[model samples]
Target chain A: MNAFVQLDLTPLLIGVLAAIACALPGNFLLLRRQALIGDAISHVVLPGIVVAFLVTGTITTWPMMLGAGGAAIVAVVLIEAVRRLGRIEPGAAMGVVFTAMFAAGVLLLEQTDTSGVHIDVEHALYGSLESLIWLSADGWGSLLDPVALAGLPPELPRMAAAAALIALLTGVFWRPLKLSTFDEGFAATLGLPVAAISLGLVVAAAVAAVAAFDAVGSIIVIAMFICPPAAARLMTNRLERQVAWSVAFATLSAVLGYVLAGWGPLWLGGTHAVSAAGMIATVSGVILALACLLGPHRARVGAAREA
Target chain B: MDTGFWQAFLAALALQAGYNSALVAVGAGLLGAAAGAGGTFLFLRKRALVSDAVAHATLPGIGIAFILMVMLGGEGRSLPGLLLGSAVSATVGLFLVEWIARRTRLPEDAAIGAVLSVFFGFGIVLLTVIQTMSSGRQAGLESFLLGSTAGMLYADAVTIAVGGALCVGVVLLLRRPMTIVSFDPDWAAASGVSVRGVDLAIMGLVMAVTVIGLKIVGLILVVALLIIPPVTARFWTERTERVVWIAGALGGAAGYLGAALSASAPDLPTGPLIVLVSFGLFMLSLLLAPVRGVAAALWRHRRFQHDVHRRQGLLALARREAIFDRLTLKVLRREGLIRPDGVETPDGAAQAAKVLRDEKRWDVARRVYRDETIAGRYDGLTSIEAVLTRDEIAELDRRLGPPVSVGPRIAGAVP
Candidate 1:
């Protein structure tokens, strides 16, 4: 495509891939009745980063990912332990563990040496969608080997990975996940190890969250996890249908967010390109708002007419 | 630890005093506790997380307030203006959440979550715009995200404390009506409790708490203080009065501790500290409280099981005939249900027998046997049938009283 069109395509591509990555894991979370666990793990993973930085003296993605994933596991375990102790409800356990872990993470981050960290806080917030422009379709793997197409975009692999992950999850555990999500006790009665399935979903969510964190900042990561599936859930009860709608919504939002951020500048009078992550979030928000308005359940309208 | 640290610590204290920190902290804590107490009822009703949505909605109100401040040529960062703006927006948010849940097929949790995130996003957008347009006049808006009690003044405390007290006092005054509405609104309505009025009052109370609490616990932790304490306190007592008092105490303690800890350290965020401390207290209460406490319950249940096992063992080993352990065996006794001797004495035995015969076990047996009757019909008359004889029935009645009046007995029934 032309440079004009290509500029718009970058963010949208990232947004779509990010959204897909986020939404795929989110569907399982929503199904497993641990939708908020994503929110919890996102906060808890901070201490992981701090611990990683303190030990390794670096801010590489791999170390951060390991730290975050470990912390997420700790949070998951804490929630389960608290619930099994029988005093705290699952939600309360989740709320307590995540908040405590988040607070601890913040405290740790405060003490860490920031000098060696190449990425500044603002850069972290802005993200590096610009990096997506030069990478090849096969990604950085080919870059180290001096592949001829090293200069191409890397969106294809990212999108492909997200699609593959979603397919694998849906294919292997679709029936069991749906059964457990709808009724855990019944699923247990059916001899399903609901706990194992739930833990598996949480791990998948953590991996997806870490993967997408590069595309979208931590804040938007939550919006992506919650918004698309949430909006899809509003219109449908069928789990398969909800997943379909979620992917469709994510794709549309990503494409639209990319285009808007890219071109809104030429028409809208702003010099800075609209942020890809911000635009995607805004699109998700818009879609949800529209759904709320158009959805059959307007209490006021229904109440008034009924009365 | 060092002179510099001490200096920083002292400076922090000075700033706190300069802003009337003690008064505000106490006021907010008291108000937060009261509101938290009121929150307990809602928690029991399983609507604890709704407050989180209300808290999130307050952000847009702050944004609007800042805009209004700009329009009115006042400092947008002023506490009163911010508080007022948040209250209005948070109230709207609460109503919208309820409306959405009621009107749509969305579950309450989803509705709350959806509203909270969306409103928060809108708030962010507003904040981003204000920052860009006003050249950072709205810098203070970010502090509200996590809360900043560092700048709390006497007036802020007084407003929240007094308002919170009034709301809580009203809740106490209407406790009877409120409880009735919560547990059984239909029955309460029949008894002249205005369910609608009670609901309105409670919602209004929740709103007041949310507004005042925004300063101390901020948006996110506000729900924690409201929910965690009440839930934690629930483990301590079955009595509503005790639960409220304990929850209030726990919440107040959390607020106070949070303030002190934040004050002790210069860089720490007060809101997170308060929530963290509150969670600690909640966990402790959940584990160790008297009746409902998890550990306590487990202890009681274990002891109870041991006693039961011992009693059962004693009975089984009794004289091998119709004997029982003596009344003073101590371990073999349970109130009402068991005696020292495993077998009841004539009087106690009669009472126990009466209760046993009252059960419809024979009727159940008859039903079970009827289905099998066509196959053989108890050719030798099943052993259980012998227990149902007229003579045995007469003897049982003489020993005990007549069996509890159920339906008429059938002669030569299936058994």
Candidate 2:
């Protein structure tokens, strides 16, 4: 029992699932020119969390997740309305909506301390990954069947849920999502239900955002969403290749980040072990930096070569 | 809201009793407008978003300044020392962003975003360290997070005023050259305009305004102030000169309003509020402008539809008359394919042609038709005795394609 508990594979498993879930939808967000929507949504979700905490008197995951999701949808709606009614450009509208929502959230938190729910600005920004303390028995059953994965432990359930959601979303909207991202006007002319596809993409991103936020804070969630897609873009300009590379990169970062965080303390003589989320961000950033520097399809190099 | 606004206004006036805050606000607004106006050219040049990068890119420099202040044991009480450090760090950051771009394959936007995030993260890390080290009094660093007019001493205001005046002076002196560069960089270069120098000058103006406005608007809202007002002003006019003037005014108004709000309500963050207000103004311009507003476009579209239908009705009536009269048609036939007796007829031809004939031309045509022919159906010719047959009018319609795509076939279609 001591060995089983000490192994502490639960967080690592959850991290993997979260990263996969995020990277899947994140690919479309990056492609659709809504690259910063994740950042926008992350900030906008603050007020939602505040409201949820105020109502529930606790910082359990579900209320905060639901609240964050609702706020994100509202943000998307607000951005659209602002663009239509005011003729403001997309980027400017997004900036205004997110900043306003974030400010409102901050103001609310400052005005009310609530019943000491412990969901403060720190939690809003840097998340409480340590909350993955319980591993559900039902979670294990769904994750593993008798013959399918009998050897796997109960921790696999969380990973299975994350993987299943990501896989299902990716499978369902793969074609239309790509078409909408490439040319929205053309997609509409083809009688594609553009509104439904766009909504699906947003919902997918919100789900992915919640899943990733559970492991890494909102601040780093943006980096996770943007960095992998950006790095993949650097490696290959083609959309298909970018999605493939992004998923692979995200999975690798999760495993490596968890391993480093779990074991590096033993070697370095410290309890703080470099934050796994930070490490993941740092690694992803480093990968992007490398790709930017060395990638062949770079504009300047391509220009120089053509010249 | 009204009473709150008035109270806020009075409190702001009181805060500016010595006129120091007022002076700083004016200086910042002037400098910000100059930066923003210059941004118009940059924005038009498709590099508006670079301002966003430059704003965040300054963070590392601010962090380095904080570190230096700590090293010199002047952390909390030294404004001059901090400013000097920040200036050096900011220039370094600018240099690094350019260098990285030169050495890499990153597109400009992605490169800008990356540089911004990395430097901002570095600043956050430095700030965290600074917080940890301070013991007796927390570093009064929260001011930088959302600007503090409480620190706007007279000297700071003067420094900003000088910067603003210098920016405006330089822009005036180089206005012609800058316009040439903006309108046609290649042409300016070919005509010996020193394109590189003009670009460097514009960049210098951007840096000066950013540095000056940093104290008034804070880091995050500085870019918005610099870009949004100029973007908003663009909707009201087509001329570049008017755009510059209006944009400058908008920026100044926003700065004044923001300062007043901040002074009155001490609790509200000034930068974000100012940005929100500016965006509100931008929305107003988009909706209500007479010439280019969305409302105007919709109105013009309706008017155009009405005019087209009215003209089509006149042409249809004229075509009916041409089909019956042979001698009157022979007179029309000589007027081209609408020949009265033996003119050619295209399958789908309108009879009435609304040509832009001058009075003299109409008088001459009327005289020619007086004794030419007075035969079959000529009722449609009563308005203007000179007749035009269906085929001739259809030929004219074929030459004029409607500007916008109407629902199906254009009503002005020859048929």
Candidate 3:
């Protein structure tokens, strides 16, 4: 129990929060056929943080966020420019831009004299979810102690706030977002700012990605952004139910993945904890696979042609 | 940054650097050419991003291969063994992406993202598990992520070179059917081309390129080699065959240059440098390629705008109206169609009469031939002479007869 409080709780909370935060915007992305935007956003985060570190000479949260946000904007603009100017497909443009940016990020990380700072490609990919331990926790009572609470891993609160903010934004903009995702022309005819809404959705996804990536890794950010929402897509035809299903799947993946990574190896008589971030992503994929096989609405019965 | 770097770069470019650097450079060039050739079909097929999933999916296979090799009492670092394992797993990931996209309602993009992240995550999990093994500390498996050329074994280079050559050969042989299918799947199916079979063949070729490129470009940046060159080549041509060949040439150049640059300095990583070089080519193409480039498009638009303004100004001159639009007057004056004070020069008067005649001919043709095709061609700028025969224009002119004297002398009054 003490180990659970001191070690498991913070990582698990952060993982769950990150998962939910990403999955929320992911539902709309999946519906809108922009699902890989999450992938592109996450890939560019490395460069964003690396540049932020270079300029500020520190890894503070705000600087990293601002840098990452700036990178996401640049990536989006470049993708659009390439798509328009070169007459390339959205997928190809996205692939080109993100890969180049990611390559630049890796090069920068290698060239800079980053000796002591915890900034590198491996750290961005797998994350340090296992190390965000709560040292001040003694047991369950530590949850109620103000001093112990103050020592809780900063990721937990930050992820929680991010997840909460995403949920609130999703709730507030549910109708127009759904309308635009389904029939863009119809939504625009109804006086909706379809273009702005689409951009807004991409912006929201970028925020979720940048916030969640710091804790759970880009792998988890991508998996959560895709797998949970995609599984939910198979499970329902309605948008509201799909969002609810996605959130549940995200929560289940985080908890089950954290537990399996932390203790499942020992249960099988192994030596140490595996990567929590990886396990969470693996679990989410398993969930998606299962939903693909069994979800009632998995077939495109009422679906129209994709744009 | 140093003279030694320059000397080394030039030596590597000439294939006289050393046995190791030359081998690495040749392997990179061959792999880039193959990937560029094979990726043309994917870019045309609109499935270019599938390479990302296939590339990332190779990780778990690498881990499992390492463990299996260790168990078999081998050093567990054979490049062929690792490539074979990676190929197997990448095939599985490709199939999964296909299966999920087909069986479920999720789009292909979602399937790609899902498979990519999961396979990579599972692979990381396996890596962590491998760390528990006694021999895992010296695995040096991380090199695959960014690629390394410092000690590329001769056998490894030979394998990559041979594999890339084979893939490019296969791409050439299969180009006919693959191009047919990529252009129009429904038509290809109707014409007995076996669209599914051709798609599977394209995927196989792409998979071969990805596996072969794993050593030179690494997986994460491998898709860049597949995508950037093809996209860059697209700016220079409209034909698929030309695009494929140009892409191969560009990819080969980028790879060769990148390898030489990296060989020049230990600090230069091969994968990013290759991608950056490729991006540099893509940028040049985007900005300056003829006909399709940004600069060319802007130039075309400007010239088109000038023509429209001049054409309208001439028409207005025929109408004997005072030209007030600044752009119209400026365009007319520049073209020698009007004098200093908006007066029509003799050349301008003749051109305005011709313009008015074409307008009246079009107005008559619209009534004479009400076919949608001919009427639809009217963009207010196309001259009736271009659309109709001489006889047809003569008939329209006969219908209007002797041209009502609009007295264009008002604008060309020779004041």
Best candidate per TM-score, number? 3
C-alpha local distance difference test of each model: 0.66, 0.62, 0.90
Docking class of 2: incorrect
State in Å the error of residue A27, model 1.
Answer: 3.5
Residue-by-residue lDDT tens digits, candidate 3, B1-415: 7898899899989989899989988889988898898899999999999999999999899989999999999998999999999999999999999998887778899999999999999988888888878988888787777677778899999998899889889988998998889888999999999998999999998888888888888888899999999999999999988989999999999999999888887778888999999999999999999988999999999989988998899999988888899999999998898989878899998999888878777877888889988887888899887788888788877887765665855344321
Model 2: per-residue lDDT, tens digit, A44-130?
777888888788878777787788889899999988976666565676666556655765675577557664566665566545444
Clashes of each: 6, 9, 0
Question: Residue-wise lDDT of candidate 1 within A1-307, one digit each (tens)?
Answer: 4443334345455667777877877776665555677667666666777787788887766787788789889888888877777556677667667767665665555445576675333333335554466433343344355662444455445545755785697679888988887898999999999988878888888877666665555545666777788777766767887888888887887777666656666577754454555566667778866766774433343464675
**lDDT score for residue B233 of model 2:** 77
Candidate 3, superposed: residue stretches over 4 Å from native: A302-307, B1-4, B408-415
lDDT of 1 at B150: 69
Ranking by DockQ: 3, 1, 2
| Candidate 1 chain A, run of 10 with poorest lDDT | A134-143
- List, residue by residue over B266-310, the lDDT tens digit for candidate 2: 455556556665666767877788876778878988766544443
**Steric clash pairs (candidate 1):** A12-A258, A135-A152, B324-B342, B325-B341, B325-B342, B327-B340
Off by over 4 Å in 2: A1-20, A31-34, A46-164, A178-199, A210-217, A236-241, A251-280, A295-307, B2-5, B10-24, B76-106, B134-137, B140-143, B148-176, B305-415
Better of 2 and 3 by lDDT: 3
DockQ of each: 0.29, 0.22, 0.83
- For candidate 3, the per-residue lDDT at B14 reads 96
Question: Candidate 1 or 3, higher TM-score?
Answer: 3
Predicted structure with the largest lDDT when compared to the true one: 3
Question: What DockQ does predicted model 2 obtain?
Answer: 0.22
